[model samples]
Target: MKIEQQYFENLLEEGSEEFELIFRSLFKEKYENLYSLLDDTDAFNEPMICAAFSTPIHIPVEQMVLGFLEPLPSKIDVVSNKHGVVHIPKLGYFYTNEPCESLEIRIKDNNSFAIFKSDKEVELISFKEEVYINDTDIEICRSEDESIIQFFPDQTENIQLESGLEKSVMHLNNAYHLIKKHTPFYAEWLNYTMRRIVLFTSPQLNSFASICTLNNAYINLNNERVSDIFFLEEITHQCGHALFYPMSIDRDKLFIMDYTTPMSHFSGIETDDRDLINAFYSFFPQYTGNYIFDVILDHEENLDEDSRLELIGRYAFRMYKYGLGIYQYQEYSDQILSEYGKEMFAIFREGYEKLYEKRKELFDSLDIKDQVYVFDLEKFKSKNLQKTI
Candidate 1:
């Protein structure tokens, strides 16, 4: 579902007094007109505006608001200086001289770059039509001097190499083609939610892709790992999180009714308070995975029998995971349904049960023995029910 203008208005009206004051102070004359543009702009960008109001960090709202209006850049340099200041040439920079709990950056305008903790602004020098930055005795050419760019972490030497960038772009193009061809709805969602994809060499060996809380999706797919199905799953999964994130902020307590107690999923992944909230709402991403496989299976003639079975197994596994998760976390899910009403829950339940039945039929036909992809529904359901008792 798309975020409407009224949602933005409600967000402003229901904001805390301090939030309203900062918003009004920063936006001044333009604050009233800003909400009208929310529906027309990128959905992912909405969270930044919400963050400007909610976050305790003393960020300049004018800069953040302006950055949202500008078109997202395809590439950006994530520069970390010797003084422990992380700079993203355009979007923002932060001081990380000491260890911190959070790694949030302060939003800055495209014209300026912050150096260290000095709060100094280094202006990009323009020569003819090109923009150059001469900072710390190093000179680099910038494609656009005044355009705001988004950056992500984990940019290692290997990831920054020209070859890696090309490979990442190629994977993205393949992903776009698959989304456009097979999942048109997801393509539209991507157009609205995904601003840009940033390539990074992930520190975690298994991490392939992730969406930063704001506008960028960070991917670490190498040449060998890049495939249409892989990219499609990653994009759709991350896009689901990106789409719902902004809504969670605007509609307070939309995902979780209680932030006091921690919760664990059926998979035994223990979530802390903050992460527990996210875990509670993870059904959307699982649903996306199931949806993608369903769409792909429609053209089963193009796939070999093994590939078809593999896709079916994945779909079944996602549905099983989602259904089992809901069954295990019924208390929390019930609260969410009661508060937000039954719309989302209805979708989750209907999809999960239908897919569960279909998966059982497929399992019998295929005689699948692989435990990784094929889920044992009866076993998990019985175990989950015992847990509740």
Candidate 2:
């Protein structure tokens, strides 16, 4: 049987009680039908409803409480927890989990160093006190300078410490809170992304999947509600980039676009250029089916230079190629360009005239005059450059 099925069965066998209690308790009001359906975890994985069904399932209890309702009334001021303090909104101070360490996070609440011990026990410490911050044990944020004591992990990205709070507090505090609250969900999310769909990878990649949230951009799971559902879909998109982010984006090694010289690489869209479009077509015939590509390359048939460049950001051949490696290049297509072969990549030419105008418009608007990397057009055209048949 498929692993998906096995996963469902396991949920039923072991997760039934937890699932029922959690579902009923949380969805008692808004999602009555969905809560009722919780009796069958197996049915929840149905294809059509899976997307819609799973959408709401993402709103775990704390997310609901933290995201929607305020856990506490405005009048209350103390926020305490043994499980660790998660700074909830008007829910102002609700400790979702117990504090693991006796972390004394000091914050300036009322012009005084209101030291927080385990999300509870607020103490006013004198500025003159020999307050030594335990980098590993406690996280501190005050006067706009929030810091995780002295955390400078060896492999972390090196960012210059800017002055004040921007360098410290907010992000780390928020990240810690989000990661603490959503560890399980994060693990499951990583599992979904790294499962069968990750056609080719190494243990390093599998490990990297867990560390994705560590990227400051996605540190806080709650902020993923930007574009459509807060840029959450974009999260997967970025992870897709990360999953295949190669040291060198080369067609010989990765799927991508090819262009020589920094200036010609992406300064502007080469409109109605049969050479460029034909080159694009020579690699990715799947563009015929991609809606976004179709809109930019196949639909808007009469775009000028300015128009084409504007839509440049939307049309990334590498992204399309990544999709190809993911869904198309595998078992789906028999077409061979050899090892890294593409079937003539001629499909992109079929709608050339029709797509030329719009595609140029997209390319024209883009200001990519600064990609110093020696980007190979074919390499630039592919998605995941690390796969082999």
Candidate 3:
């Protein structure tokens, strides 16, 4: 399975229609019979439908496929995307209006079941998970089935879940506008890849810890004061990993070893090459977002003084991680990337180098000594205020 360099490069490029078609073709091949059977369903044709096959949080593809083996109104266990909504195979969806994990639903039993609503045809079931934390109820943001943005209930006294969720959503919207305004292709790429955003509290992390698998991103928001630029960096970084996962499904095509090798858990232990490459690749887009922020801070006016300074500080913090990621992964890439993978790595490195050169002056202006790994608003503002902000 000798894939071309263009295929690898296009996958990293983030907005290649050709690569999207390639992904669909590969996905179809993986589930040939199932794909053909449910080709006409609206659920199968969604832009972000690939998200359903992701690990940890996913609508089980096997169960949906198995549902087709039975009759039209078969009994199948389906998981809800948000709280109470479930998408049935062949038939439409049903709502339960409560927290749910998985429930058995009668697809189209006219005689044996009662309709919950007149418009949609789905039989309701009796299975609900209580949505509570410390005897307090928390709200869930139920967006469309294609994409969901959810927040974890407050765990600590300092944690303000409602305010944090609202502000994070605003930052996500603003980040999309920045990407669209600067790089429209990147914005479209984000729409196609990112499916869910989960904001939670993590006391162990100083500022935050964000990790993404497939279309889902889990962001720890233990820190109170997060800048607008922080969202820009994490959104792109997490989504970048989401996009890269499917592309590397065929291990022989991209890597010398099995690409699905689990990451090392022990401290100072070497991780698999796949993890290293993906980590470095995720930073490529983060740097692109940084580049966009630089342009925004330089040209865009009427921004609040504090906001500008905040962005500059976070931008500097993100830039350090972006550079360090690529530097750490350079040796691993040389050891494990196949011929096609090498070409892709070369292209990614070249892209980062270009952005680095352009941002040289901005880098020189920042006080590197005061810059910290975790986002510190005061430290960032104090050290990075040398500029016109």
Top candidate by TM-score: 3
Please give, for residues 1-389, the per-residue lDDT of candidate 3 as tens digits: 11233554565454434445554575588778666665543334232344443323345564444323434544455566444666433233455663345555444465243233334544465332322111111112222233232122221233343345656766656655665666655666555544445455556543222222244555556654655566666666555565565555444665666554433421245644435444545654554566666677767675677777777776666676667666655656656668887766665666566666776788768875565545677776665676634
| Cα-based TM-score, every candidate | 0.54, 0.27, 0.61
Instruction: Answer with 2 or 3, whichever has the higher lDDT.
Output: 3
Better of 2 and 3 by TM-score: 3
Deviation in Å, model 3, residue 145 alpha carbon: 11
Number of backbone collisions per candidate, in order? 0, 57, 0
What is the Cα-based TM-score of model 1? 0.54
Q: Which regions in candidate 2 have their CA more than 4 angstroms from the true location? A: 1-115, 118-236, 239-310, 319-323, 326-389
Cα lDDT for residue 67, candidate 3 = 28
Candidate 2 local lDDT, 31-98, one digit each (tens): 56544534443222111122222333211222223213222212222332222343322112333233
The TM-score measured for candidate 2 stands at 0.27
Cα lDDT, model 2, residue 29:
63
